[model samples]
Target chain A: MTETTIAAPERSRRANLLRTQEGVLFVVLVAIIIGLSLLSDRFLTVNNLLNQTRLFTETALLALPMTLIIISGGIDLSVGSMLAWSAVMLGFSWQLVGLPLPLAVLICLLTGLLGGVINGLLIAYVRVPPLIATLATLAIYRGFSFGISQARSARGFPEEFAFWGQGQVGPFPTQFVILVVLIVIAHLVLSRTGFGRWVYAIGNNEVAARYSGIPVERVKFTLYAASGLMAGLAAFIFTSRVTTTRADAATGLELDVIAAVVLGGTSIFGGSGSIIGTVLGLLIITLLRNGLLLTGVKGDATFMVIGLVLILAVLINNLVRRR
Target chain B: MATQAGRLTQAHRQRGLFAQQEAVIAAAILVMTFVVSLANPDFFSATNLLDIAVNTAYIAVAAAGMTMVIVSGNIDISVGSMLGVCATIAGELARNGTPIPIAFLAAVAAGGLIGAINGALVAYARIPAIVVTLGMLSILRGGLILVTQGRWIESLPEEFFFSQRSTLGVPNPIWVMIAVTILVGLFMKYHRFGRAIYAVGGNAEAARLAGIDPRRVYMFVFVMNGLLVGLAAVLYASRFTAIQSNAGQGFELAVISGAVVGGVSILGGTGTVIGALLGSLLISLIGTASIFLKVSPFWLQAVQGGLILLTVLVDVVRRRRRA
Candidate 1:
């Protein structure tokens, strides 16, 4: 091709990239980083970045499964409640039931898995809408959490458990490392696997996917189950870091987790999303909160900021994705 | 053409089920009443039944508006937050000696304004109703906290407690609820706009083709929802002298569940005011019955969740059979 023709195509390609979901997310992420750095002197520090990200591991873990679930045209609103339930179960199992640490963790994970299975069976077998099914479980799971813990908190986990949450390997937080590993695995599964393709197929059109021989129900079941498992993992980390587990742990966190996935450019109606975008979204949220808190805006003010960001993110996603 | 036939049958079946569901709900309430009274005769006492009526009336009033929104193919989870905001505003205004009428009108106006904003965004911006309302829920809640500075508003004028006054033999709220329900029933039954909501929700593309503006309908339903929320807020305050920042934290879920249980399809375009009212009554009765059963308060959440799931499951099965 001639020089001008090549140059024109190159420019158009770059423009096209900017219009993509990930491209827009990256730009917003970069802009937020720059803005926060400008607003707070402490924002650019490695210490602050690490600490902020570490705080986000809980949400990040939930978001990974959430991304996949949403991509499959389903939502798990009970994940936050599942986190609390699993956390309480873990604490009670270890402290009250006198189980070993590993056994307690397994119980927590199993509880979450069981919760997810219930959600799956409700939606996949009964054909209940994911939203309603999970919304019901959200309350049911939360009630059980309080009933099991009697609204009490359990603290004083063994030092080794705390280390899993608090320790770092050469500046990387153990929790953050765990999240990164999960993200990589999630990213791979979503981008390079038949199961991922099936997820997208189902999300794009469930009936069509079924007609094409995809096991729609089974896939949906697995997605929800996986979401619950991740919530369990998230709960484990959160309880370990805080060294406490309560009935109300992770209260109102469903919004934060959903917001992260949506802000990551996942279509709420489903069929499109990426683990990378979610990670970027998570980073943006963590940094925004860190910067805002550092600048002395806390509590409800921060909530407003996060809420606005979520709305704006969706708004932008809609605008850019409009044909 | 086949799909159109299916829609017709579905609508016809729903109309049939509408009456049957009401009967079913009434019977369910009666059965619970009988059981509870057997366990503890006090549950059937006038005072307890009156309390249940008052509480059901408040929720049913909100559910009436939500029924319209859902029937118009949209959902608003922000009703609870809207109630909180309206309560705080009216409470603050009443605390300042603003006349009840003026404060009431102001709260309704503010609620309408918020709803209008939500409507505009959903209609014009093409944002999903769920996301819009979810964002609004957080924004309004955070804004309320900021506005109230986390302080409780107390010392409202006696006039604001007009809902406590009985008309003839019934409490004011029950009467107001009856009046409101009748008005909504009339509107839905006789008004073109009301029919337009059903048409749009049933099939928006067809609605557009038939010269109905779905966007306008969406806006109207949301605004109406806000107005009802405003009224509910007033009633809420009249019932309680003190209004806290989190006056209606989970109220939306309760109200929505009532609507859902009342047979208002979450998928929209199929519900009735009578059904919604009955649904609210049944749920309220269950709450009282739980007390009579001597169940721990924590179990109520699980019970409510189970009820919602069961209702929706039944709905799905019924729809499937008709289809």
Candidate 2:
């Protein structure tokens, strides 16, 4: 029975491709962009596009490692909290230790990686479930962020740091360019590297991957560490954009990143997904948010619309998959 | 025949032992309450006890529904958002001179509608429950913010407030909670529909083979959960006298924790209304004790995390022993 059940899907591989999520999501993205542009004059403006792209950069950065982690059959619910912790650490290191800007940034990223390593060790070795493990780390990291920052905002970073948040290059926002470069690198690694294949294989079946000689624990550990590093990088950009670091910064961004991944058609149960789809998902979310804002919908209302879109996207994804 | 009788008796004895385990936890809670009261004489006062009950009522009622949902192999992280949405809608209706009961019904039905959408996606469309619900959480939260424009609604009708006032010696919220508990408890034990829920959770393929439609069970549980969330919203609004856009933020965690602590497995398959009620009481006790003991509010999240870890760890150990 098991053989038959597994074999049935393999026999229809070509049909599965035609029914893949990316094609459907791409069509939806194009339709939404065109529709929103038709409805609002500002939707297609270059300035508005740049602003929208900038807004998505933080989540997009975090989503890269999140994509890999999810593909590797784990989750990091603490990334948003980790971002706050990293930002706080970066601020404290610069102000108290007088570390140079580059060193401070590296310290922040390393802090994130270490936090991720702790989570990975607990999950992969200690045998804690990913959800519970990350949930605990989420609280711990958030608490640590508050303790170190004394629940206060940290300011006075060097002026040059603001360039990452506000600077422009060739008619595009710097953040947008950064996100695009990161996306390209991430896409290549996932598509071109054996490490990427191993991630998918692990997600698909840990036992099978182990039997095939994949270093399951090491791959999982690295994916988690990578996720934390990306979150740290996101924190850097976010702090720069705001020109301040608060212990409470990015309080709920993990939800947004996860929403984008799921919106992009990544199976939450793991195994199959794509970077391109995630990029498109990010665009869709950003545009929807910007469009609602331009329509004079307040932030709260905009959140509701995003929630609706998320549900709608998943419903459509499921419908497609079933067919 | 003798061997068969011995095996049957052993199974009965094991079931009795499981029941005793639940009783032991309940006794521990009683003892802890007594100890806490002794330490803080104010904790034993009528007002403080009533306050604890009122606070636990909403979460307890919501957790009951959530327990059933989780036991049936699904989860609803959107309860918090649903509560916010329901409260906002109720607040709006009350302000518009709608009778209190009508507004309350509208609030609950609104939650039911959201749940139905979740049900359709998860059951009919075959999407994974976690992804669909997680997306719903964001969408609902966003919707609440959008509808309220990040503003608090403080103009609920007088009758709406009055309904939460004490009836005899018991607060109205407590009575409502008791009513809900009895109904859910009876349903879980006696109703064919209820038994089918357990069957589906215990083994979906087997349930399917037994001519049960697991999808229907999924849809029913989600809808029921939504209604309960709406009920919670009414209580929340009355108690606070103000409904913020972010009302019930992170509520899913509280509900999930309560359900799990009450012996509901995160993996799903088993739970009890009594267990969930006790779990809610335990959490409320901790929260109230923290305040009475003058523990820093900063430690609340950490303590909650610790309690959750402890509960799940014990549950795992117990299950292993049983196996």
Predicted model with the maximum TM-score: 1
Worst 10 residues of 1 chain B by lDDT: B1-10
What is the Å distance of residue A104 in model 1 from its true position? 1.2
lDDT of 2 by residue, B197-289 (tens): 877887788788888899999999999999999898888887767778789888887888788778776666677888888888888888888
DockQ of every candidate = 0.66, 0.44
Best by lDDT: 1
| Backbone clashes counted, model 1 | 0
- Per-residue lDDT value at B226 in model 2: 91
The best candidate in terms of DockQ:
1
Residues A221-243 of candidate 2 have per-residue lDDT tens digits of 88888888887888888888888
User: Model 1, range A219-243, lDDT digits (tens) per residue?
Assistant: 9999899888888888888888899
Q: Model 1, which residues run further than 4 Å from truth?
A: A1-19, B1-19
Q: Which whole-number lDDT from 0 to 100 does residue B50 have in model 2?
A: 80
* Residue pairs clashing, model 2: A300-B145, A300-B146, A301-B145, A301-B146, A303-B142, A304-B142, A304-B143, A307-B139
